[model samples]
Target: MKTIIKAPPRRKPQSAGATTNRPGNPATGKRLPYGLADCVIFLAIAIPLLIAMCATGRPGA
Candidate 1:
């Protein structure tokens, strides 16, 4: 009988304070603004919360 073992995947090491997902990629010093998709998503979630707050006593009410 034989058993097979799998090794865990390896990950690249990132320096502390990694800002890969920030408004700008600090690591590469590149400016990247939010795309239209990001804006749409923000609005999709924000609008519902705003509407719920305005029409009700409070959130989860």
Candidate 2:
């Protein structure tokens, strides 16, 4: 009674002409501008929420 263990298959190499489907790695154009815009929008929404939370929690509103 011997158990035969099977090995997992290896991944295939990408072709030179194959397009990358991953984010933040566009084949053409820049990805940094969009990233910065996202950061700015996030901070804009977060700052007000934090300030409101602090204001409401204060003893003297």
Candidate 3:
């Protein structure tokens, strides 16, 4: 009976702050003005939907 040894797959080397290290990447670390603009736009759409749903909701249904 011959035993086969399977070696573990090698992993690629990652930099010290490659992933989720926001401070290392300024572009990803800080929120842009456009992000706030997008939030405002999303809120504008969401609030109206919420109000409409509330106003039209049936008591039992």
Candidate 4:
């Protein structure tokens, strides 16, 4: 006479809900890439800055 044995069951794959499991928000207070580094210096006068230039000729015309 002979004896019989049983086999174990296989495991199923992970579901969809288990994939997206994030903790918290990362971008709380982030700085810009070009923060004041890329600026421009504009010069008002061209040839000579005279005292007469201070007076607005038209006065906000």
**Top lDDT model:** 3
| Pairs of colliding residues, candidate 2 | none
Give lDDT per model, in order.
0.82, 0.84, 0.85, 0.56
Clashing pairs in 1: none
TM-score of each: 0.40, 0.40, 0.44, 0.21
Off by over 4 Å in 1: 1-32, 58-61
- Those runs of model 3 whose alpha carbons end farther than 4 Å from true positions after fitting are 1-34
Model 4, range 1-61, lDDT digits (tens) per residue?
Answer: 6877777887787899877766577665666755353532122342235445656356775
Task: RMSD for all candidates, in order, please.
Answer: 10.2, 6.7, 5.6, 19.5
- lDDT (Cα, tens digit) per residue for candidate 3, span 1-61: 9999999999999887786644755676566667878999999999999999999999888
Winner by lDDT between candidate 4 and candidate 1: 1
Model 2: what TM-score? 0.40
Order the candidates by lDDT, highest first — what do you get?
3, 2, 1, 4
Model 2 over residues 1-61: C-alpha lDDT tens digits? 9999999999898897896667765656755556878999999999999999988895865
The list of candidate 4 runs beyond 4 A from truth reads: 1-18, 21-23, 26-30, 39-61
Rate residue 36 of model 1 by lDDT: 88
- lDDT for 58 in candidate 2 is 59
Ranking by TM-score: 3, 1, 2, 4
